[model samples]
Target: MPDERTKYAWRKAILAARAQVSVAQHAREAAALAVAAATVAQPGNVVCAYVPMRTEPGDLAMLDALVVGGATVMLPVTGAPGPLSWARYLGPDSLRPARFGLLEPTSQALPPSTVAEASAILVPALGVDRRGVRLGRGAGYYDRSLGAADPDTKLIAVVRDDEFVDELPEEPHDRRMTWALTPGDGLQQLHV
Candidate 1:
């Protein structure tokens, strides 16, 4: 396990990285990049994502792109520590401020189990490494939700380019990512 200071270092690195790119620009570019890769790698119609909060990556543009691409989009809703709900992302109007300063669907009930049905899932990360180890908001939310995904689901971490690195400390029960999407690289599979 990483020491407390090392964990903070990783988080600090990501914060520094994101500050280099405009959030609006990076979101639009990264979404287009990941969507293209996901289209080729995944065949399922449903894509699940989490709404952005604080300094985490946002997928507002990504969700719009998915809809335009004729794919169904699902947004994760925070539930009990280990479970999450997935609601259809109808559009901007469908979202309202929710817990954690995030946005969520106000009119859909696709159920939390919908996460298991996704062909692809885009998650926010404070940092992630080539080994696919992700450092989230220390909530263990994704670690739990990912355990429920189908084995081949495209579990991607969206981050600024520098936050996606060559290595990160690994641990058992740490779910690996299938890819990392960034403004510069688009969709890059973890190979470190």
Candidate 2:
């Protein structure tokens, strides 16, 4: 496994690149991602997803698509740097600004173990690799929360097409993604 320093460098470089994407390009990608999200949203399944930050690969429409496809969506509620708490995602109107400039659901928070209810979890990542390693923003919240998910639950990392790379630094505690969803690629299975 690569050291934390290497992982930190990768995060910095990838985030810098994402920051340079044009607004038009970001919107187009987000639209395509929304369509792709619909394909994996099984009816009546609970999908744990997040409200994407401005530079992230998706938009509110992606979560909306999951709901329209008959899936119940749950979004993470930020707290101390630990396993994330979750809340049912009612709709766009249900979100309110929270810490770290993130939009979170206004509903009552569910315990971290509630992640076990999800059949699929759409994880946010700066990048993911062919071997299923995910590069997150260094918060470690997803790493902690994902441990609560059932072993069979599908972990899908949402990123831009080019962000699906050949390799990324992996630590023992970093959970592997079962699949990757990109605007151009739709869904690509990773070796987990």
Candidate 3:
């Protein structure tokens, strides 16, 4: 299990690095992420995806590509805030401001168990090791929500290229991702 200090150190370092990224660079990477996301999704699949916030990599572009590819996409809707509930991604127009500076779909909220329907879940991560250990934003929302997912569900962590690392401190409760999706490298499967 990861010690509290280790988790904090990694989060602080990655956030600092991410803050140095230029707006122009982030936009370019977001576009590339869209291309990679299109390839990861297949027609008629259900995908659970997150809308990037602040310096988080891969914005709605990835979710939009999943829609264009004929996949049913679900985005998180922050409510009382244990495990996140979900809502369908209708389009960019469907999003509205929500708590914690998040943009959520205006559609009806679905139960957290809704993630079990996903064939693939594109999660937001600060970093992920090649071993599939994902470092999130220190909130355990995804960690809680993902526990109900089907074992076959593909968990993909979306991060910047440099965020892919050799190892990360992990916990038994932490769900490991099956893949890491980066802007430059596209989608790379993780081997635990």
Candidate 4:
């Protein structure tokens, strides 16, 4: 296993690459990702997801697609950076700008434990390997919040096609993803 410093380097490199993505390419990937991600949103299912930030792989369209697909979408509400709280996503109109330049739902915030109700979680990742190791932005919010999810809940890491690699550094506390969702591959099951 690599140390935290290696993880830091990986995050920096991946983020730098993400920043260089062309605007046209980002739009194309976002459209494809929206279609691909919606496949996991079955009617009556509850999905825990996040609004992607600057240069993130997804956009609001992805969340809207999930809602249109009949899943009840819950978006993370940022606070003091432990486990994340959630709120139901009513629509694009329901969001208001919040901390970290994120758009959060204006609805009442639910406890962090509400993640346990999700059938699937669309987690943000800078990258994910075939073995399901996820490289996040080092906040540890998702890692801590995911602890409340049921063991059977599908943990899917959302990343761009090129960000899916063969290996990444992992720590004991890092939650392994069950699947990777990309614009090109859609949902590929990982070898957890």
Candidate 5:
């Protein structure tokens, strides 16, 4: 398990790197991410995904792709911040500005347990290692919310191509992802 200091250091460095992405490159990557994401969304399946804020990678395009691919999409609703609640994603127009510079669904808030209904979960990450450990923004929201997902659900870390690495620090409570979805690479199964 990684200590708090190590985790914090990694988070800082990773976020700094992500922040350096140019606006043009980011837009291209976001489009690629959307196309890649669509491939994983099965028809009639529920997909739990997040809307990208700032330079976090992937945009509403990713959510739209899932919808176009015939999957029902849900986005996280920020609440008190331990675990994220959920809301059905109607379309781009359904989003409203929320806390922490995020865009959340304007629909009814569903409990965190709603993740169990998803066949695939598109998790945002700063990085993901070869071993399947995901590095998030240090919020711990996904760690808590993902605990309620079905064990069979495909937990996928969504990142830029270079953000997928050989290793990342892991803690006991961290959830392991079985796949990584990157803009350039698309989806790849991980050996957790």
Candidate 6:
């Protein structure tokens, strides 16, 4: 476990660093790269993306491409510090405001059986590293909830381009990222 103070500082640093990337060309290029990476997803790759919040950015415009390409999409729901409950994408009608200022699915959450079905999961993190250490939103909720990720699941972390780095202070329990996503680059398989 990370010391709370270090975790807080890391989160602040990451958010601040991400703010520097406001150029239209940068954003456009990054989105295009991310979307292209997602489009290459093979069938049976369960894509676990998030509803953006706290300034974490992604290419929402590419969702239809992912759907039309025949890949499965699921989003994480905040639960009682338990296993994450996933729901199949049903478009904008399924979302509602969630605690901690995120959009959550308002419709029916899928069965627990669905959680282990994903082969690729896109997790939201403050930062991630070459070794896959993830700095999340200080809750450890993802670590707790995804304790049961399928062995084949690609536990990828989504962050802005600058957040991908060579190292991060880590703890024994920190979840390792299998992949890291950024706008400039689609997805890079991490060493973890």
Instruction: TM-score each candidate.
Output: 0.83, 0.96, 0.95, 0.96, 0.95, 0.84
Query: How displaced is residue 173 in candidate 4, in Å?
Result: 0.8
Each prediction's whole-model lDDT (CA): 0.73, 0.93, 0.91, 0.93, 0.91, 0.71
Worst 10 residues of 5 by lDDT: 1-10
* Candidate 3 segments exceeding 4 Å error: 1-5
lDDT of 2 by residue, 79-178 (tens): 9989999999999999999999999999999999999999999999999999999999888999999999999998999999988988898898999999
Residue 42 error, candidate 1, Å:
7.2
- Per-residue lDDT tens digits for candidate 3, residues 1-192, read 223448788898889888999999999999999999998688899999988999999788888999999999999999775898999999999999999999999999999999999999999998999999999887789999999899999999999999898888898888899999999999999996
Model 1 agreement with the true structure over 1-192: per-residue lDDT tens digits:
233446666776667766776767766665665465445233348788766665565456666776777667888877667767778889988998877787889866665568888888888888788888887767777888787899888898887666776677666777889888776778778863
Measured with C-alpha atoms, the lDDT of residue 25 in candidate 1 is 75
True-structure lDDT of candidate 3: 0.91
Please provide the root mean square deviation of candidate 1 (C-alpha atoms, Å). Answer: 3.3
Residue 18 CA error for candidate 4 (Å)?
A: 0.9
TM-score of 1: 0.83
The weakest ten consecutive residues by lDDT in model 2 span: 1-10
Model 5: per-residue lDDT, tens digit, 1-192? 233437677777778787889999999999999999999788999999999888898898999999999999999999887988999999999999999999999999998889999999999998899899999887899999999999999999999888798888899999999999998889999999
The sequence of per-residue lDDT tens digits that candidate 4 reaches over residues 1-192 is: 233448888788788888899999999999999999889899999999999889999899999999999999999999997999999999889999999899999999999999999999999999999999999988999999999999999999999998898889899999999999999989999999
RMSD of each: 3.3, 2.3, 2.4, 2.2, 2.5, 3.3
